[model samples]
Target: MALRRLSTLLALTFALGAVAGAVGARTAPRMWADQLVNVTTDDLRWAKTRVRVNVDHWDPGAQTGLHRHPGPTVIYVLDGEVEEVFPDGKTVRLRAGQGVWNPARTSHNVRNVTSEPARVLAVHLDPG
Candidate 1:
């Protein structure tokens, strides 16, 4: 039964290792929803001035009400088509795999003008 005991120990070790890895990955420095709404920021290497992470989702016909950024921001299209509306009412269409970079303090809005829903990974610079 020593072999059985060793097998059990190995299994336990593997399980512990998996749990540790998962916890480490979750706690690792990454974006969370709190940063966007509350403006709670942590280490922002991307936004050397001020880093903010805002993962946005949009339904068909949905739009991101008027907003502005302090620094150039990145909008990575996740799916479907989106129109980035500028203050002048001009719009830039971004399809899947496309991206848009807005300069500091650029006013704009995001809308899913298509029938399909879309998602975007918006990374706005805090410029701290």
Candidate 2:
């Protein structure tokens, strides 16, 4: 299906990015992401509840390495601007107060394109 093709494309893009990083062929600032909350439980049918939240900070020109989440992720821009890139070369610019939903297993990258540092709140839902 369409989703499968998109996932495959994203995986290839991530692989290429990883290779570029390993060879020092890329020039992007490193991002700092800190997990602020992680809660897990075991009760119902999807049976468990797991919430993973992270606060990500990026210096000017900094970016996150290509990565994917185990589950869908929601991101809210807290400060500055960000350029989000998808595996298929799609790009989006998000500003403060904006948000995005990242599909699970889809490779993507987030870049801080402004002069100031950028911050974003990321939340993930999981069943464990």
Candidate 3:
């Protein structure tokens, strides 16, 4: 009986630990990108253009530090909300289903100011 009780107690403890770890991971401030498509083509006038599509995940209060792309890019919010901050001090808030276009070499940063996590689909037309 004592051995059985110990085994049960160990299982409960492990279950609780797993739940806690999951919650912690969900709330951690972080960002990740999942690339969906990447294609390079020479058919366009510019020639050798790379088209890339990615799904980006942002945790609550997560931010992408100032950055720039080599070519034009578009970001569409898929869930939650995000704010885009430009180098010239301009800021734009985008919600689910909304999107923005950034010209080549435009420097900016993105942040999730809300309490909930956010996700966005990013499409890029980069010069190859």
Candidate 4:
């Protein structure tokens, strides 16, 4: 029940942010985040994974340096527009409220394309 409530809250927050971006509202330029979960201690006999949520405010004309993820990642575009670029020059554009799923071991880069900063929430689940 607690998890349900948290999920509902996140959904509402994302919805409002998306609507604000679509309307070009002033509220669309920033990012808001929830705390990280998966605080289990690591055990040698098993694999424990950590979960983290990252809210990013990507400045205009800004791009993320190349990075790697050893785990699966899920990201939501809360406001404005951003592009996820691959090493081969492929790009996936995310608009307000769009969600993306990245497989484990994926490597990529990102850039914000709009005049205003882009807001995004990244949920990462560590690999076993």
Candidate 5:
């Protein structure tokens, strides 16, 4: 009976450790991204383009460093609010139901200015 109790205690300890690890991983800072749509335009012979759509979730105060896309991108705010900074030092705030367009190869940075979580959907029209 004593040996059986020891075995049970060991199993419980292992299980608790696994659960704690999982919880910690979930709480870690990370960006959650989901690709919602992908399509390639075949009708245009000289200007064929690939379109990709994504939904991105940002943690509070998270920011995407300055980056540029291969093509124009349209971003719509889905929840909370975010600020977009252009290379010219201009900034704009977009909240839910509002969107903005960025020209191809436009350098910009997106940052979540809210104290709560935020989400946005982006549509990319890529030529390549």
Candidate 6:
């Protein structure tokens, strides 16, 4: 009877571990970006600066952990939806065709709270 009880406990532990792992995985979905263009600004005002454009993809439930950029950035949603959370507790939900501008050194987090994947076009202007 003791041996049977031990086996049952082991099985229960294994089942709990599997459940925890699955839950952990769901909380941090993978995200990626595709660089579409990178060039140097030639205009007089922003001369010598780097202009980069990328297409960022976020899986359902994915989030860009609190972060900041060295340069000014712009994000335009191409598909799906995303929530931009600021350090001061502000939250903004953006949908397709919407956009937002983030100044340099701004701290924020972008999350895909929806069940569908999201695509965003990002433009960055970095000082050279």
- Measured by lDDT, the strongest candidate is 3
**Worst lDDT window (10 residues) for model 4?**
32-41
What is the RMSD of candidate 4? 7.6
Give one digit per residue, the lDDT tens place, for model 5 in 5-105: 53564355334433433343323145533312222222223446555555556777788789999988878776778899988899999997678889899
Measured by TM-score, the strongest candidate is: 3
> How should the candidates be ordered by lDDT, best one leading?
3, 6, 5, 4, 2, 1
The lDDT for every candidate, in the order shown, is: 0.60, 0.62, 0.67, 0.64, 0.65, 0.66
lDDT of 1 by residue, 8-72 (tens): 64355334433433342321112323212221234434324454554455667777578887777
Each prediction's number of clashing residue pairs: 5, 1, 0, 0, 0, 0
Off by over 4 Å in 1: 1-41, 45-48
Candidate 4 wrongly placed segments (more than 4 Å): 1-47
Q: CA RMSD for every model?
A: 15.2, 13.1, 17.9, 7.6, 18.7, 21.6
Query: Ten consecutive residues with minimal summed lDDT in candidate 3?
Result: 35-44
- Candidate 3 structure lDDT: 0.67
Q: What is candidate 5's CA lDDT for residue 32?
A: 34
In model 1, the number of clashes is 5
- Runs in model 2 lying further than 4 Å from the true structure: 1-47
The digit string of per-residue lDDT tens for model 6 on 4-25 reads 7535643553344334333423
How many backbone clashes are present in model 2?
Answer: 1
Per-residue CA lDDT of candidate 3, range 1-128, in tens? 64575356435533443343334343333533331222222223334556555556687777878999998887877678999999889999999868888999999998889988876667666787
Lowest-scoring 10 consecutive residues by lDDT in candidate 5? 35-44
For candidate 1, the per-residue lDDT at 7 reads 52
Which residue pairs come into collision in candidate 3? none
